[model samples]
Target: MPTEGVTGANKGIGYEIVKALCQRYNGHVYLTARNAIKGNAAACKLRKLGLYPIFHQLDIGDEESIKKFRDYITKHEGGIDLLFNNAGVSFNECTQAYAKEAENVINVNYFGTLHAVEILGPILRYGARIINTSSFFGHLSNIPSSSLRNRLAARSLTVDGLCHLMNEYLSDVRNGVHVTKGWGDSPYTVSKVGVAALTIVLQRMFDNDPEKRQISVNSVHPGYTQTDLTGNMGTYTAEEGARSALFAGLDAEGLRGQFVWDNLAIIDWYAATPPKSF
Candidate 1:
């Protein structure tokens, strides 16, 4: 039987994704969150709606938590048919120092998501699907430095190289020279850009895996959703925001290494105009 999972699904767009999967997917859907109480509550709510979704505790920021979840899936489901890298954090106000804010945001949003994939990718079933919930702001055009942009867009850029770039950004932030170094002002934006880049990198790796030929990996901009992440200031509801991600996760076959817009159309990540709603 096919099995799928979503991370950070206790609430908001992630929760909506899990709910949609339970209603439409023809297999087990796991709703995961760092907080067990909230994750179970979300699962119960789905049960009330006549949809059954299993709950799992997952903290993408913690490697131990990730390994535990991977082990459970390996033991119980054998392998995952679909995985959504959705757990993330953002700061509405820059109350904290730039360096501190950048570190915390990058830890959970980029490195954390990348680590989760590293541990789980090997167990993905043949023809599996992977979707990373990136933002339109994550487009390569967000980086103003021409050299940095070109390096990121290079076809030969490897995962290690990406990690090095992210690390360099953090180092620059720590030295209070990120802006001078041509890094973006918003750490959240940079982290999501890393997520989008990682999506393509993973897709390339999957292409080399003979056992996982048909697996498609893509990043999606879930529109501007009125979720806690946005401080409820967005134009769309959580349910509406989840539509593009849900479409990509459950459908969008053969669409690997691409950036999908809120309308579910594939866009050129480097050249497309930024979505105005975000």
Candidate 2:
């Protein structure tokens, strides 16, 4: 049977994604979290509901942790058919130096995600589906610099360039010059922008890959939802918020490198427009 894995699935939308997959997917679903105690607790809760989710520990911010998970998957499952890079960190306020906060957030949301895909991409089965859980503010327009936006969307841009671009943002943040550099102050939004961009670029690589894995990569904006990420202040619940990602990860057909809304609609991230209400 095909196997699937999710990151940061102890709670929130990630947990809901695992729950939905366990209920519907005709495959083994692994629910992973960075914290072993919380991860196991979440798995127990699901077990009470008669949903069995194999709990694994994953911390996207840590490269060693990711490599361990990758090796575990390779040994236990041979490979995987689905991967949801849903693990991320976001905060409404920063108590410490903004740069420090930016580092942590970007490490998990952007660089960490990039690394996860880099390590796990090889294991994705032929015709596998990969989905990144982006944010509503992940659009290119979130960055005020037209030049940076153009660079990000340039056909010549590669994963290396994406890494450099994000590193530049961090340097600017540390120097307290991110605003002048055209990157907004919100690390969460910027990192999510990286995720969205990663989705597009990854899909391109997959399409042109000599291996011809025929994998499809896409992104989903789950809308503002109530969860730990948002301090439980949102218009929707976690279960409802997960629907968009579920659609992208499991149900999307003939879609590759597209950004989708919570209402199951795809849009142009290049265009700066109001987000559609689900």
Measured with C-alpha atoms, the lDDT of residue 168 in candidate 1 is 94
- What local distance difference test score does each model get? 0.88, 0.89
Clashing pairs in 2: none
The C-alpha RMSD in Å for every predicted model, in order, reads 1.4, 1.1
Q: Candidate 1: where are CA atoms >4 Å away?
A: 275-278
lDDT of 2 by residue, 105-180 (tens): 8888998888888888778888888889998889888888899899888877788898899999999889899999
Error of 1 at 160 (Å): 0.4
